[model samples]
Target: MSDPNRPGHPEDQPPQGQPGLGPTPPPPPGQYGQYGQYGQYGQYGQPAQPPYGQPPYGGPGPLSQDEITWGSAAHWSALVAAFVALAFLGPLIVMLTKGTQSAYVRRQAVESLNFQLSILIYGIVSLALCLVLIGFLLLPIVGVVWLVFTILAAVRAGQGEEYHYPLTIRMVS
Candidate 1:
């Protein structure tokens, strides 16, 4: 089946920058594509050629599901694990599940889990220390600091950024 998001058949795509001679124009509106409504070019608009070495293919066609899965899971695992015990297990499972299965996903999930666990431990320590203070009002402030750390890490990871957790216990690679 022709991909609705894309156009024409895969075999018909001409090499980038080399539209085969006698190229056919995209179908006008009201014409039914095997997929759906045509966009800028039509059912099989021009091959989405991107500048060389710029993350390759454009418009979301280039990313494999595995890449997206890894990054997304890793970023969220950190934040989610903080609230849910099951989420705490996310990283451990990912580490054991074989990063080889999908290196990108495995890496992301493990890193996120590690970072979150660290933050959780730090919060506990901070709270205990706060109890020793006169007002003990400093406990919430410490929690907020760690929360900020988790938020920033998650946002960066979501954007495909790689960050290592400081002082994480390296139980798995």
Candidate 2:
């Protein structure tokens, strides 16, 4: 039982204007009070299904001409940064931005990113081998190969054709 001496106790006093009754009972199930029915908060308790004939939420839209241009640019970005040894940043930027809008651009960007990363790995390995004197011979070869493949990929992308670099590890697919 509730204590009568306790402050603000229900047993001590009935609700205002209803002296004979005790504390008011909660609204019955499925009954709405001040807010809507319980658990029906914002964006919740509502059907997640999209209307009929519409694509799913966040699904990739059709590839647009602008997206194709950006896809081509993604490959070219590698060359722009290749001078500074950060070729990955170019494709990465495209993938994070326009890539979200179209699957084609995303695929192109991912391919370039993987190739650049492979080049980085090869460069590092070649540098370590410099201690054995063989790296000195491999370094220039690696650079030339990287340049050629990058240009070829960029050209393919510009033509709206898919390009996959040879000898690239399938990382960040």
Candidate 3:
């Protein structure tokens, strides 16, 4: 059943326009806030800006070129080595080893590098524990695990999302 509160339902809803006058005038540029500033509808139902310090469009502009860089997860994911050696561990290492000052870059770096590093660490740890399992067992596991995680990280990177590794040893700055 249709709810009365829902629009287009025959219920207590005010028809658009008919604000008691001619066609509603286009909201002035500042009607919703100043250029590059946000505004909201006022008493007469006009646009007004959001609170101060907020972007005029409601938030900061979309991602920039700097945000979409080579060191980004996208690039890391695409790299063959990332799929082979790092899987998740390579990107994690590279991300952590990044030297840039951009928070975005640093964040991505940390993630990609961390994931790769984790897999590497796990493989090493598992191999060293050969007494518990056969030596060759970890090889295929590492390969498949690396491939899956590498692609996952790469996909995230392509979307410009950051990747972080867990339980990593911060060897480099």
Query: lDDT of each structure?
Result: 0.59, 0.82, 0.57
Off by over 4 Å in 3: 1-60, 71-99, 163-173
Candidate 1: tens digits of C-alpha lDDT, residues 55-84: 432333343756665666656665566576
lDDT of 2 by residue, 1-173 (tens): 66789987766666654467755444455444234443334333342344358655545455567877988888999999877879999999999998888778999999999999999999999999999999999999999999999999888888888899999998997
TM-score (all chains, Cα) for each model:
0.48, 0.63, 0.46
lDDT of model 1 at position 92: 64
Query: In candidate 2, which residue ranges exceed 4 Å CA deviation?
Result: 1-63
lDDT of 3 by residue, 122-144 (tens): 78877887777764787678657
lDDT of 1 at 43: 29
Candidate 3 overall Cα lDDT vs. reference?
0.57
List where candidate 1 sits over 4 angstroms from the true fold.
Answer: 1-63, 85-87, 96-100, 134-138, 166-171
Question: What local lDDT score does residue 59 receive in model 3, on the 0 to 100 scale?
Answer: 56
RMSD of 3: 13.0
Candidate 1 TM-score, C-alpha based:
0.48
